[model samples]
Target: MAQIDYIYSAHSAYAYLGALRLYEICKAHDVVLRHKPVLLSPVVEAAGGLPFAQRSQAHVDYFFGREIERWAEWRDLPVISCRPTFHDNPLELPNGVIITAQEAGLDADAVSFAILQAHWRDDADIADHQTLHALMEGLGLDADALLEVALSPDVQEIHRRNTEEAMEVPVFGSPTYVLDDDPFYGQDRLDMLERALSKPFAASNWSNPPVDIKAGS
Candidate 1:
């Protein structure tokens, strides 16, 4: 089975948009999907991308507003708001839960989708420990046990390692699917990713620009 490294973030709207479809695609193709939750703000910034809150209102309205609305409708998913009430909350707790759940042999994707739903559809706060526990229990996970591992030093270190790896790959944004070392960034590129799985696409022709000694002078 082909394996995909899903460099993900819990609070990402695009991640939520692509979650179910990715799952379906993986199932259809007999692929194994590994979810890696990380700190998104730094990853986006390191990739020379703008944080959503820092973007212009026009950009936000177009992408986060219209684009999200259209995709949600197309995907037949419910998104109560473009910007959730706790959208900007700290992600450590939620991200940690996902990592720990996967470590515990639970359905991390299901848990991840539930977290995304609670935030985007239900306007719930995932930053709260109590909320995370309730979500884990609702998913039939051992809430107390997972929480213990979720907050452990090793798991925390794994989260940090994930962030570093995301930066190393230089994943431009959330929901990036890397298959056979080829990165398909954005939910929009999912089709191309699927096609690539059938027959690998030709390598990109991008080459580093030559050093311009006098360019900075």
Candidate 2:
């Protein structure tokens, strides 16, 4: 079986934008998707990209402005015009809880998509414990038990390992798919990802293809 390693930030708008389509692709092709939630700030810094706050105003505006609107419409995912209410806070808690769920024999895709929807669509604060508990309950999972494991040393270690792997891959942003040795960044590159995953042994190169962000929109 082929593996699709998904390296993303829980709070990334891009990840939120790409979540559903990625899920569909995995389901259709029977791909094994691994959710690796890493801190985007450090990954971007390590890859020589500026943090969100440090980036030029033009870039920030483009990201939080028309780009988001266009992609949100294209992907048909709900999103706020501005950043989400809890955008500033880290989503490690809920993300860690999802990781715990995965370790506890829960379907990772189900838990990951649920977490993303809770934040992006429902406008829920993923950093809030109660919100996470509610999400767990909604998933028919034991909220208290999962919350306990979410803070456990074992889950924390898994999260740390995910971060380390993301750093080693030199991933610069969210929604990154690493198949074999090639890295496909951005949600729009999912089509190319699907093609690659379906033919893992093929000798085609798609890493860093010329991407026209405005053309598709």
Candidate 3:
């Protein structure tokens, strides 16, 4: 079976946008999707890319203006026009919960997607402990128990390791998939991801194709 390593930030808008479709693609391809939640700020710093807050105005404007809208529309995913009300807050609670879920041997994809939906679709404050508990419970997960595990030092180290590993890679953004060492860097590159999955061992170091908004961005 092919291993699809999905390295992403838990609070990433792009990851939230592509979560469901990526899940479907993995299912169809019979690939094992390994979800690695990392800290985007650290990864970007290591990759020599500026954080979203520090990016040039042109980049930020393009991201908030056209890129998000076009991708959301193309993917048929619902997204808020402006940033979420709690976008500035830290995401440790929710991300820790995901790491805890993985430690508990649950399907990381289901838990991660649930957390993403809570933030992006439901507009829930993922940084809140109660919100995290509710999200886990809704997914039939043991909220109380998972919360205990979420605070474990071991689980925290896993998140740390994820971030460290991400920093070693050339990935500068979220929802980056590493299939057989090939990195596909965006949600819009799902078609290429599918092709890579279909030929797991094929030698290809493909990057994200430039999105043409008018021509199906």
Report the number of the highest-lDDT candidate.
Answer: 1
Where does candidate 3 stray beyond 4 Å? 200-217
**Model 2, span 1-217: residue lDDT tens:** 7778889877778888888898889889887888888767878888778777788888888877788889989987777667678877875787688788878888767677777777777777888889888888888888899888887888888888888888888887888998886789999899999988766556665577665758963
CA lDDT scores, all candidates in order: 0.88, 0.81, 0.82
> Could you estimate the TM-score for every candidate?
0.93, 0.88, 0.88
Best candidate, TM-score:
1
Which digits, one per residue and each the tens of the lDDT, describe model 1 over residues 1-217?
Answer: 8999998888888899999999988998999989999999899889878877689999989888899898999888898855888888998889998998888778999999989888878889988889888988998888899888887898889899999999989999888999988889999888888888898998889898776657852
Cα RMSD, each candidate:
2.4, 5.5, 6.0
Off by over 4 Å in 2: 200-217
The local distance difference test score of model 1 is 0.88
Residue-level lDDT for 210 in candidate 1: 71
TM-score of candidate 1 relative to the true fold? 0.93
